[model samples]
Each structure stands twice: as C-alpha cells, then as structure tokens.
Target chain A: MVEIKNLTKRYGGNVALHGISFDIKDHEILGFLGPNGAGKSTTMNIIAGYLPSTSGTVTINGFDITEQAADAKRCIGYLPEIPPVYPDMRVEEYLTFCAGIKGIKRPDVKPQVESAMERLHITDMRRRLIRNLSKGYKQRVGFAQALLGNPKILILDEPTVGLDPAQVSEVRALIKELGKDHAVIFSSHILAEVSAVCERVVIITKGEIRAIDTIEHLERSMTANTLLNLTVEGEKDTALRILKDIRGIKEIKYLNAADGRVSCQLTLEDESVRNEIMSALMANGCNIAEMSMAKLDLEQVFLKLTAQKEKRSSLQDLLDETPDVSGEAPQDAANDTTE
Target chain B: MFALYKKELQAFFYSPFAYVLTALFMLIFSFGFITSIANMDSNTLKFSFPEFFYNNFFYFIFIIPLLTMRSFADERRGGTEVLLYSSPLSVTQIVLAKFLAIVTVFLFMIVLSLFFPIYAACTGKVIWSALICAYAGFFLWGLVCIALGMLLSSLTGNAIIAAIIGEIVMEGLLFLDQVAGSRLVDAYPHLNSVVTWFSMQRRFVYFSQGMFRLEDLVFFLSVTALVLCWNVLSIEKRRYSHA
Candidate 1:
C-alpha cells in the first residue's frame, strides 16, 4: 500500500508536482498517464525515495519515505525510465546482485534470481553481457531486476517504451501477472498500452492530476458527442444531404479519400440515433461499405483532459493581464474549483 | 552493503579496469623496489622492502585514482546509480562498501609486493621493526588515498573528471611538501610548521625512518577518516537537496 499526501516537488522556481495526493491500494495495477514534461517521472522518483519532495510526505506500508527510507524502500521496487543497468555485467550476475541488494536471504538468492529470469523469459540470456543485448532484451532484464525480492509495491516508469509490439505485449502480460500479488504503478504516454494493462488510470498533465478512474469511466465522463464513421460508394453531396436530414444529426464532415468512394464523419447529438442513421442510409441509394460508431479511444480522452487544462490556464493568463475588474470574479471562482 | 561490496569488487576484475590497475600497481612499486634496493646497495645502507614502499607512497598518486575513479563515476555514468539509490541500503553503506572494495584491491597489490621483501630476507638480514613501521605507514597512506579518491568519485558522474580530480588531490598532497619548501613556508617562516603538516610526503617520512609514533599514525588515520566522513556527508547532502 502507498499513501502520498499533498506531495509537492519543485526544482527551484519550477514546480514539478503541486500538492498532489493519491493512494494506491494493494494488488491494484494503476497506470500513470501523462505527456512529456508532465512530472510523471518526478513523482515516481519521489515515491521511490530517489528524490526528495519539496513538501508534504509519502508513506509505504506506514513507513515514511524521508524518515524511514530504508524500511520504506525495502517494500517497493522501482524501474526508472532509463533501465538502471551495468553494461559490462552479465544478466544473471546483475540480477543476483540486485537480489543481494534487496536483502534476499543468501541461500534463497539463486532460486529467486532464476524464478525472476524465468518470469521475464530471460533465462537463455543469463550468461550474456547486458551491453551486448538488444534494447528489448535490455528492457526485459531491467524489468527482471525490478521483480527481484518480490517486493509488495512495484513502481515502473514507461515499462513498455522502446519495445517491439510483441515485446510490449509480453511486458503487458508480465505486468498483468504481477498485479495478482503486487500493487503495480506503471507510467506511460502510450494510452492504449495503459488501458490494456492497468486496471485504473490516473491522467496527469502539467504537474497536476486531471482525473483518476477506470478506462470505461473516463470514456463515459468526457464523451458527449457520438461520432459515426461511414464509408459509402455514392456522391459525397448526396450522402451529406441525406445524413443531414436525419434527426439528431448535429454535423457532417467529408473525410479525405482517393479510392473513388465518399467517406464521411457524422457527429450525432445523441448516441441512440446511431441505429436510425444506419437504417436510413441502407434504405437510401447509398451502399454503406462500413458503418460503425466511432468510440472515444484513450488518446481522445487524454487529449481532451490535457487540452482542457491548457484552456483553463490560458484563460487565467488572459484574466490576469486584463485590467477589467468584471472578469476577475468568474476567473477566481474557476481557479478555486480547479485547485 | 556486503552485496554491493561483493558486486563492486567482482566488477573491478570482470572488466579490464581492475586487472590493468593491479598490474600497473605491481609494475610501479617494483620499479620503486628495485631502484630503492639498487641505491641502498651502492650506499651500503640497509633498506627494507616495506620501508622502500613507504618512501614511495607517492606512487598512490598514480594508483589510488585508478582503483577508485570508477567506483561511483562509472555507476553514475552508466545510470546504475538509480539501482543503488533505490535499494534499501543507505548512501553511507554504499559509499563505505565501494571504498572497502578499492582498499581490498590496493591490499592485494600490497600483498604482492611482499614477495620482494621475502626474496631480500633470503639473501640478506631484514630489519623487522623498520618493516613494521613501513607497512603501517604504507597501509594508512593507501587508506588516505582511497578515501580521497572516493570523495572525488562522488563529486561527478564523469570517470575522467573523477580520475582527474583524484589525481589532482593526491598529486596536490604529494606536492604540498614542495610548495611548503618553495613558496609559502619559505616566504613566511612563521607558517612553516603548520604548512609542513599538510605535506603527505613529510608525514610518511617519519614512518619510513622506522619511527612509529602514535601521533604520526593517528594523523594519517584521522585524514583517512576525515575524507571518508566528508564523502558520506556529501552523499547525504545531495540526497536531501534533491529530495
């Protein structure tokens, strides 16, 4: 279990994390989602006891990171964005050393190392030097290192970054397996990967958390307009006109194409109109090649949340520069609610 | 800490760094040994092997950095500092383990130098008291160099920077006697004794002469302790500042 309360971190004048608080329950896999320069790594470093938070406190299983760092760190395993590895050391040797540092009993080290290597499917490369391994292999070795000592809490930053698609799937499966016993928090900018592997998602932007919820919940909360993608072998103008006549149709936009077919995006006021529009298109002369409701992917949700934050901050800047007193009250109230 | 110490000690030998350094240590010290014995043969004055090593403690100026320069710098450069920092081990333990590893390597080299003395003892009369004094002085002097090199290694993640800074500190202490002779103490007569204490070469001279006084032994030990303490403090300061 991990509890971070009002955690604030600043590098001189630049605030990396601002009074952010979050709790990770036991055995839950939480995805930390954010763009570049979004303070994800900074927060992970603070929680792992690698960097000091500017203010506030962090506790792992009731042990404070600053006051009881050794005991606190003992319960947690961290894989930094850059896999901390010694290039010259062999994979088996590196894992053995990691196990030792993590305080595995001397006699238990070999079996533990073997089990971890097996979990990451790195048993074959045990004798090979890490520097000579490929990036995907290196990442797996890094993951294997974090899996040492079987710590209760695992904090991994961008665990699937720089891996091939197959390797990413393997790592995702590995993380999912880890979630059965350990509280895993992995940070990533890859939205789909987080949705696939993490049970809960914490969306962050510009040093602050925007929302934390399940993937389905995040989609439900931000999705108001229903999008429909329709590919038809008909005149573009006739298709647009027919769709516009349908009730609940808000707007239509012609999509780019070169295949002698008209493809258009239909925005609906209500999602229930999907069936009506599909039936109407079929009845008309338009032959619908493919028709499906455009679902709001994680990428859309992420962009919406971050873009909302940018809007709020830019509006605040405008309010700050304005000499007009009338704009101050609403702006101040918005800022209060956001904080 | 033991885990770190074991890994670091093994790391030195796994790569060419430790092997090269160990071989270089033997080469340099043998040169000093052969030269000292050859000179003593000409003068007909008795010189023990350890005594000759004590007189050439300045060889640490070249050897100690090679032993310790990669301790933290290589780890930091390689991004392995993350693993060390994230582990349950305290920074003090981490630094101490690394220092001990380098000391072990230096000790191995020192043990190898013992063969030279054994050869001399078989061929001539050996002075035991002088040999004890010289070994004590050499061990403590090497300790000082190890501590100093560890401190320099902790200052940067760059191996070259660590080595350069380590060389400067060791060479600076070696040249302290020269500086004391040519400039500050020469120009300021009243400051001679105070400045002379800073010269590591002058400090080792008493032990080389077979004088194992507690004051001289304590002085070198204290310097070693002080540098180690400074290294621990530096690591702690960086931790809290970044935290």
Candidate 2:
C-alpha cells in the first residue's frame, strides 16, 4: 500500500537518510529496526508527509505525497515519537477532532471516535483531560487517534517507548491485530519487540540499510557458521591453546572462568567441527563438562549485521597506501619489547 | 479546516484566556468612555465615540498579540504541529483557520465594547453613522494587527517571545506614524509620502473623520492579506528546512 523510492533526507550538511527504499504491502507488518539517531523518525516523518524529503518520493496508495498531499495523507494514520496530543483537551473531544480532520463524515465521527476509544480500552478516560492521564494512557490515546480514520497505512514511531511491559504487550497485540487489514510499520531499537511482532524486519544503522529479511531468514543465515559453547574443567590457558589449535575454529571468545572451569564460545566452519574439537579436548585431558551447538538468534543476527558496517578510519587507509615506511620499523621493534 | 478552526476557538473560549482578555477589553473601553464624558466640552456638551476609539487604539493593540501568541507557537512547542501537518489540510488552510479563529476572538472583544456606545446613546445624544464607521475602521485595523500577530507567532516558536516581539513591532508601526508627522520627515516630500503611505494610523484618521475612502479599505485589507500570506510561507519554509 506504500512505496518509498530512493528516499533521502539531508539536514543542511548532515544526511539523515541516504537513498533508502522500502515498500509495505497490504496487510503486512513491517518492522523498522534501528538504534537512536538512525533516521527512523526521519523516514517515518517523510512517509507521513510531515517533513518533505530532500530527494526521492513517497507514494501512498498510488498518490504522490508532495503532488497529492491531501489524498496521500488521508490514507495514512501517523503516531509520531511524541503523541502529538493537546493536553488540555479531553480524550473524547480530541479523538473526535482527529476524526473530523481526517475528513470523516459528520455523522460517522462519533461512531469512529467511540470505536477507537473502545479499541484502545480508553473508553473510561473519555471525559478526563489528556494531561491528567498517565503516560501509558496518553500513548494509547495517540494510538487511538491513529485508528480513527481507519486508514490503510499506519506509521507508528516507537509506540512502546514509555509504556510498561503489560502496556507494551497490549500495544504489540493491537499492532498485530491492526496488521490483519492494514499495512502497519512500527519502528524500535528493541530486538525482541521486533522479533515478537514483526514478520519481516528492516535493520538500519548510520543512515544505511544493513539488512532486510524475515526474522527466520536472517537467523538461519547466521546459523550456517555454527557457534559452539564449550565449558571445560582444565587450566584456562591449556584449554584455550587446545581450542586455538583446532583447524575448523574460525574465532574463539572467552566467556568466563571460575574454579578451574573455563567456558568459551567457538565459531566453527561447519557443524562437523564439534566432533573434532571434542576429541582433541579429551586427548589433552581437558574434561568437557558441557557442550552445545548454539544457533544465532535474532539479537545476534541484528548485532552482526549492524556491527559489520564500522566506518574505516583515514589513518588505516593512509597506512594501507604506504606500507613500507622506514619510520614504522623502529616503532614495531619497540612495541615487541613492551609486549 | 473547520474542525481546526473550532478547536482553536475552543482553545480560547474554553480556557480562562478569552474571558480574561474580554474583561480587560471592556475595562479599557469603559475607562475611555467615562473619561471622554467627564472631559466633554462645557460649551457643546459633545462626546464623540470616534475620538474615544482613536484614543483607545493604543491600549487595545496590546491585547491582540496575546490573543494570537499561542496560535502556532503552542502547536509547535507541544509537538502538535505534526498532527496538523499530517492532516488532510493544506498549509494555507491551516494558516487561514488559525487567523480566522483569532479574528473571531478579536471580533468578540469589539462587540463587547459596543455596550459603552449603547449605554451612552440611552443617556445622551449619539452619532450612529460616524460611530459605525469608527467601529468598521477599528475592526479593519485590528484585522491587520491580528494577521501580523499570527505571523509573529509562526516565526517564533515561543509564545512569550512572539508576544514581546509583536508588541515591539506594533509599537514601531505607531512610532512610524509619529515619524511621518514630524517636521524632519515633512521637510522631505518624497520620504513623507512613503512613510505616510505605510502609516496605518493616518489611514485610520480618515476613517475616524467619517470618510470611508476605498483607498484606506483596500490598504488595510491588502496589508492584512500580505501578512497572512507571509505567515503561510514561513510555516511551509520551516517544514522544508526543518531539522
């Protein structure tokens, strides 16, 4: 229902979004995953027609956002990072106003407002001033405002930021329910929230899209490397040396050591490498107390995808360009003695 | 658009803001009325409502910025601008709705001030034609001030700062009237003509003398429209260059 093409946003000299493109199909729940300052809100704001993109276009249900803003905006229900609520207005009064602005018929406004309040379970707080409500209730009121027009596309920017666990779950459930008929896109830095509620996730960092795939697809892709968790009762150095000697071990990271027992995580080249490591540890008299092959979950996949894009420094590039500097030889000799 | 307009009106009337401002407006008008009556000429026993409006313009100008200060600034500070921007309404519609809402409040104040003229008419002689002309002229001048005040509100995102700057700008306009009449400016015919052309008080004087010139009407309305257009453009500019 929404097609965002080559969307770029620049704030003076700084780029907030760099030609990011994505689409939301009807009845789909697309999760926008990113850390803070990752342009998640910027992208959402552009899609909602609040902020104009520096370049590119957002087409909602075939209406260009800039060319046909009124029609395009009529198809969207946006709840910004802040609730965008008037605290002085009553809950019911506020929702009715929302419905009216959404171009709902005069007679239909009351029913739409009532149904929205009912859905958010805020019917009881209808008469109360929004300022008097708690944060969670205020968020629900914002969410309820989005549901007023029954728009096909819903863009929620961190809807669960300030809510308690139960309220978060309730909002998740509401989003899941809304996804049945609407193209719902919600953003968050919380991996578990995305995994729990979203079928497909878009991982973004540093104004770039790191990965976009289903949760299962991303986790399965990362599991191909095969992570092994090994806890051995032996000298920490000896166990580490033995694990290092294994041919299939790509990388080994120490978890912890206590009471002469060392636990370490090993990234293996294949699943069969576990047997070779087990036999090699047994031959060295390092008793393997416990061993398990760990599959990379959504969190690990997210970390790997986001962390792999670390920026390269200019110093490293300079060194790579001129590798044979005579001044580096004496420094290397001095560093060896310090080590 | 109507929904937003209604909400803006509720923001004024539902709070104590409209009532307090209306009370203050009536107080100023009654004070002007009583003083004009007390200082009436003993030979003629005449009290001109037009002169009362003219003398009261300075005090009445102070309340306008207060009425318009919260129109756009509060929406921005409270993060509700997003709601308005994302709605199906255009920028022009939003600006026009807010402008009309403040104009409505100003009209309410003007209508309430009419109680003085009506009370004076019951007790003594009153000139209805000149009085109505003065009322029209005052309302037109108020339209220009209201539009200018709303423009300031849009430019500054803080209500208090918008009000302060609005007061300064209004005072500057009144000061321009003084400068236009000064001997220094009158010495140069070219500069005097330009200053008098932009001087709203001089045009208002023609209205107070019971002369409804089309030139002054068009000037007041066109200036108000120009300011309202500026308000709309500034809002759109902020959204474009929004950080």
Scored by Cα lDDT, where does model 1 land? 0.80
**Candidate 1 has which clashing residue pairs, if any?**
A52-B243, A53-B243
Listed models, DockQ each: 0.58, 0.81
Candidate that scores best on DockQ: 2
Q: What share of the true interface contacts does candidate 2 keep?
A: 0.82
> Chain A TM-score of each model, in the order shown?
0.74, 0.75
Kindly provide the TM-score obtained by chain B of candidate 2 when compared with the true chain B.
0.98
Q: Which stretches of candidate 1 lie over 4 Å from their true place?
A: A222-224, A227-295, A310-339, B41-45, B48-51, B181-183, B186-190, B240-243
- The first chain of model 2 has a TM-score of 0.75
Candidate 2's DockQ is 0.81
Q: Tell me each candidate's TM-score.
A: 0.83, 0.87
Query: Candidate 1 residues B59-169, lDDT tens each?
Result: 757888878888878877787888898899988889889988888888888787778777878988888787777777888888988998888888788888898888888
User: CA shift at B223, candidate 1, in angstroms?
Assistant: 2.0
